[model samples]
Target: MRAAIIHGPQDVRVEDVPDPAMLRPSDAVVRVEASCVCGSDLWRYRGIRPVAHPVRMGHEFVGVVEEVGAEVTRVSPGDFVIAPFAFSCGECVHCRNGVQTSCVRGGGWAGTDADGLPVDGGQGERVRVPLADGTLVAVPGAPGDALLPGLLALSDVMGTGHHAAVRGGVREGSVVAVVGDGAVGLCAILAARRLGAARVVAFSSHAPRQELARRFGADDVIAARGDEGVAALGELLGAEGADVVIEAVGTQGAMEQAVAAARPGGNVGYVGVPNGITALPVKQMFNRNVSLLGGVAPVRAYIDELLPEVLAGTLDPGPVFDLTLPLADVARAYEAMDRREAIKVMLRG
Candidate 1:
């Protein structure tokens, strides 16, 4: 099998790796069909996030199940499925509470499996998926070629975007503002519309990103940043801030802008992986009665509901992929994303 391995910053390669097998009765082996490069993957590619050892990369995928462990009764060998980025035991306390992102027994692509075995990640030709019953969602039929990208989006980006809206407590006819125009943030714009937001505001300076945000349902586009940007948002909302704010960027500037753009007692749903050491003005937040609540997105919890929308053609989140490349040219794809030349790169195996 061939996999995408990152040897160091800006160095991604497609090389042969040992084939995966079902090591436990709860496991399954999936033949990769479609996988995309996520914004999080760029954190390591740009050297902002360290990679001490060469390891597999990529966490969003839709594939075909080639083999399954003895205990995997829900799916069979020939099933097509979408594998969530996180692996969780369906029976955990956190999972039962609709917060599978913090499940006690499961971990993301970076953790151990239900059987106490390490899980093989996405970004490969074939990989072993542990906790099959919990992580893999079977599609009723093979999706058409055109629906591939949308189906793939359900695995991570789209789901994460929806999580932001849910966490932000978006209500029908509410005014919502989104900070950050990355893939997830753009999807949040779409999710806000789906959630029935009356007005959606997006803050972005890039032309390409801002255009996409408008297409997704943003009623107003603010091109400024910093204090000017905050004032622009307030003006757009008739001198009042938004009812809910979504912070998809983890930087101090982004966080501050999100808080400043929300009305008193409003919420900020943030899912960007924080770089650690973020400064927050607790005094301002306390005075404004603002609430901040969000972290790693519980993407797995939203897949079932979002998948049907994708299948129904009501939502098309596939435009997030501005570039596509074969697995062999993955290094160039990584560079394209790192340099901001591509919004999101789709890698086909």
Candidate 2:
């Protein structure tokens, strides 16, 4: 099997690796049909996030089951499925309560019994999915080739966007402000519309992302940054702030802007992987009664609900895929994203 091996920063190469086999009664091996280079993948690619070993480097993927363990009953060898970025044990307390991302039995990236078997990432010809029953969702039928991108979005980005809206308590007629224009952020904009947000404000400086954001349902696109951006948001909202602010940038600056752009008693739903130390003004939050609630998006919890929309073509997130490359050219995908030449990169395995 040829997999993308991350030897170090900017050193992802396609190399032959041992094919994954079913190691447990709950395991399943998937022949990856489509995968993507997520924004988080760039953290390591740019050396911001460390990769100590040449581990598998992607998570968002859709594939067909090649083999399944005896215990895997929900899906069979030929079923096409979308694998969530995180694997969970459905029986765990967190998972039972619909918080699969924090399932007590699942651990991400760091491999261990907690994470079950080391599942190969999607940026490869094949991948081993742990806790197959709990992690992979079988699509209704063999979807069209065009639906692949949208289906693949459900694996993580789209689901994460839905999570962000859920966390922010977005409802019809509510004003939502999204801080960031990354893939997840754009998806967040789409989710906000799906959730009935009357007005969606996206802060983006890039022309391509701004267009996508508006197409996704952003009523207003604010092209400013820092305090000026916050003021612009205030101006757009009639001197008030948005009812809900979704933070998808995952940086301290983006977080601050999100906080500043929300009205009193609003919610800040964040999904960006925080880069180390983050500073939040607790005093302001207390005085303004702002509720800060978010963590790693519980993508698995919302996959079922969001999947149908993609299948129906009511929600098209495929626009985020500005660049699609073969598995062998994943390094160039990373470079395009890292240099901001592309909004998001989709890789076909």
Candidate 3:
């Protein structure tokens, strides 16, 4: 088996590695069919996040179950499935409360499990999925290749975008604004509209991303940043800012702009993986009575609700993947995203 390993900044290689095997009775081995590079992964790839040693790459993937542990009854070999970025035990209190990301026994991909057994990364031929019954969602029947990207999106970005919208309190006839134009932000536009937002604004400087934003249901695209961007959003929505704002970029500037662009009593749902953010605008938020919501999205909680729409063709996030590459060319995929040459890159395994 081959998997992506990041030796250092700008140095990702796909090399032969040991094949994944179940190490626990509740685990399963999944033969990955598709995976994608996430914006969060770039933190380490760009050296912003310390890469002290070589590490496995990728956290989003959808695939077929190749083998199941003795206690795994929800799925079997040959079952198509979507693996959320985080693995959680379904029986935990947090998971029962719809916050699977914080499940007491949960963990992330590309890392060792509680027992210290190796967990293969998603950007590989196969992965050892812990908490198989709780982490893997089975898809009905055989889906066509055309649906792969959309299904893959559900593994992370799509559900994450939905989480932001939900946390922002988007509802029927609500006016919404989204900061950042990455894949997560683009999907936020779709999620807002899906939640019945009457008007959605996207802040994007790139022509291609702006076009895609409109296609995803953004009524306006403001190509500016900082105070200029907030002012533009205010101008579009009048003296009162948007009813809800979604922050998809984990930067101080983006967060500030998101808070500034929201109405005094509105909400700012942020899902970006925080990079340099040292603090929040506590005083400003206090003065404005703005509600700050959202964090690492519990995507597993939303997958069941969003998966049906994706399968029905009513919600297609597949367009977000403008570039697709073979797993062998994983490095190129990372470069394309880091260079902004691709909105998102899908890897075919």
Candidate 4:
């Protein structure tokens, strides 16, 4: 088996590694059919997250179950499945409350599990999926390659974007503005419209992303940054600002813009993996009565809800993947994303 290992910043190599095997009764081994680089993965790739030691890469994947532990009954071998970025036990209190990301027994990919067993990353040939019953969602029947991208999107960005929309309180006839134009932000536009937002605005400076934003249902695109961006949003939505603002970039500036783009009493649903943010505008938020909501999206909780739509072909978030590469070219994928030459990169196993 081969998996991507990040020896250091800007250094990702696909090398032969031990194959994944179930270590727990709740675990399953999945033969990854498709995987992709995530925006969050760039944090480590760029050294912003620091790679003190080499670690496996990737957290999003769609695969086929090759084997399951004795306790796994929800899925059997050969079942096509989508693995969320984080693994969780569905029986936990937090999971029951629809916060699977905070499940008492949950953990992330490519890290040691509770029992100290190594978990393989999705960017590999196979992955040992803990909490199989709770973490893997099986797709019905055989889906062709055309649906792979959309199905893969469900593994993270789509669900994360939906989380942003839900937390922002998007509803029928709501006016929404999304900060950042990354894959997650683009999907946020789709999620907002799917939730019945009447007018959705996207803030993007890139031409390709701007086009994708419109395709995803953004009614307007504002190519501005900082206070100017907020003013642009205000001009578009009037002095009241947007009814809901979704922040998908994890930067101090992006967060500030998100807060400023919302009307007093409006919500800001942020799903960006925070990078350099050190403080919040507590006093400003207090004075304006603006609410800041959302965090690392519990994508596992939204998979089942979004899976049907993806399988139905009604919701296609696949277009966000503008680049595709073989697993062996994993480093190239990272470089493409780092250079902003690709919106998102999909890897075929």
Candidate 5:
């Protein structure tokens, strides 16, 4: 089987690897149909996050069930499925509480071992999905259909966006401000509007991303950064600040801007991958009465809730996939994203 391996920063390559086989009763082997690079993947690609020995790449994927274990029953061979980035056991307390990311019986996919070897990432041709019943959502559609991109987004980015909006307390007529204009942030804009936000302000300096943000439902775009951006948001709202602020970049500066953009008593949802050892403005938060919300995003908990909209043609997240490449070109995809030439990259297996 072919898979993607990251030897080091800026060094992603496609190479032959062992094919996956179910080694646990709860596991299933999937013949991956489609997978993609994530913004978080860039953390390691750019050396912000350390890459482990024999690093495996990719986590977001939508594929087909090729083989199932004796205990697997929720899906069977030939079923189209979307595998959320993390694997979880449905019976865990945290999972029942709608926080599957911390599921007691599950963990992340990449850089972890399976059958005494580094787990194969979704960028591979086939992947062994742990806790298959709990981690993979079966969509009623054929492979390579028009819904693939949107369904694929559900595996991570879209669900993460939905989680950000939910945590930000976006609701009918809520004034929402999203900081960052990547795929997740764009999806946040879309989710905010779907949740009934009357206005959405996106902070983006890139022309392509700003355009996508508006297309996703942002009513205003702010190109300024730091204090100037915050002041611009205040002027737009004509109040203390926006009712809800979404922090999707996970940088210290982005976090500060997000906190400053939210009105007193409002929520700041920070869903970016927690970079820069973030330290919030405690005094400002205390004085202004602002609350923070958001974490890794319980994608499994919201997958079912968000899928119907994607399948129904109401939510089109497909546009986020600005570049699509074959598995052989995984490295090129990463470079495209790194250079800001692509909003998001999808890989076909």
Candidate 6:
């Protein structure tokens, strides 16, 4: 099978890899129908994060089950499914608490499978999914290209954006602000509006994304960065900053800016993969009475809650994919996104 591999920074390739099989009783082999390049994937592509060894790439995917392990009863070979970015046992304490990302037996994608074998990346024709009953969510039917993108978003970006909004405590008439203009950020704006936010302020430096942000439900758009952005957000919300702030860029500067743009007692729901900024100003947070909420999104937990909206056509996140490419042209997909020519790149297998 052909799959995507990241040899190093800015070097993504489509190459033949060994096919995956159901190596464990909890595993399933999925024929990937669709997957997308996530903002987090750029962390390694831009060398912001190290890719020391050649490894499979991609995580978000919606596919059809091709085979299932002996113990996998939740889904069958013909079922359509969405595989979140990570695999979890679902029986762990953390999973039970709705944090499957921290499930005791869970692990991320692009590495080895549960049986210690090479796993095909989501950007491939097929993939080996461990914890099938826990990580793979079965959709009612096999959706065509039109509905696939929205369902695919449930695997990661959309779910993560929803998680950010949920953590930020968005409610009716709430003033919401989102930092970052990437796919997750735009989805955050949509999620905030869906959560009943009266107004949503989006931070976007790029013109195209700024337009998309507005389309995604952002009431205000700020093209500033750093202190200028904080000030802009502050100016919009008056004495108190936004009621809830969503930080979708995982950088120290973005984190600080997010904290600065929130009102006293405001909540910041951050779901960006933490690239740095490990230290927090406890003093500042304590004095301002701000609450920071976020982590690897429990996608499994929210899929059920969000799926209905997607199925009903009430929530269409498919527009976030500004560029679509075949799996064979995945390198170009990465390059396009790296150059900011695309808001999000979807890959068809």
Candidate 4 — which residues are off by over 4 angstroms? Answer: none
Instruction: For candidate 6, write residues 1-349 as lDDT tens digits.
Output: 9999999998999999888876889889999999989888888899988998888899999999999999999989999999988888899899999999888888888887555676667999999898999989899976777898899989998989999999889999999999989999999988999999999999998999999899999989999988999888778788957989899988888888888888899999999878888876667778998899998898888898898899889998889998889999999999999999999999998
- Ranking the candidates on lDDT from highest down gives 3, 4, 6, 5, 2, 1
- Scored against the true structure, residue 15 in model 2 reaches a CA lDDT of 89
Off by over 4 Å in 1: 114-116
Per-model lDDT: 0.86, 0.86, 0.93, 0.93, 0.88, 0.89
Better of 2 and 5 by lDDT: 5
Candidate 3 per-residue lDDT over residues 284-349, each given as its tens digit: 888998889999999999989999999999999999999999999999999999999999999999
* lDDT comparing candidate 4 with the true structure: 0.93
Give one digit per residue, the lDDT tens place, for model 4 in 1-349: 9999999999999999998877889999999999999988998899888899889999999999999999999999999999999999999899999899899988999997878889899999999999999899999998999999999999999999999999989999999999989999999999999999999999999999999999999999999988999988878888767989999999999999988888998999999988789887888888888898899999988988888898898999999999999999999999999999999999999
Write model 2 residue lDDT over 7-28, tens digit each, in one string. 8899888889889888888888
lDDT of 5 by residue, 294-339 (tens): 9898899988998889988899888899989999999999999999
Q: Which stretches of candidate 6 lie over 4 Å from their true place?
A: 113-115
Worst 10 residues of 2 by lDDT: 108-117
Clashes of each: 0, 0, 0, 0, 0, 0
Q: Score residue 219 of candidate 4 by CA lDDT.
A: 92
The deviation in Å at residue 182 for candidate 1 is 0.6
TM-score of each: 0.97, 0.97, 0.99, 0.99, 0.97, 0.97
For model 5, state the Cα shift of residue 123 in Å. 0.9
What value does the lDDT take at residue 48 in candidate 5? Answer: 83
TM-score of 2: 0.97
Give candidate 1's TM-score.
0.97
Which residue segments of model 2 deviate by more than 4 Å? 109-116
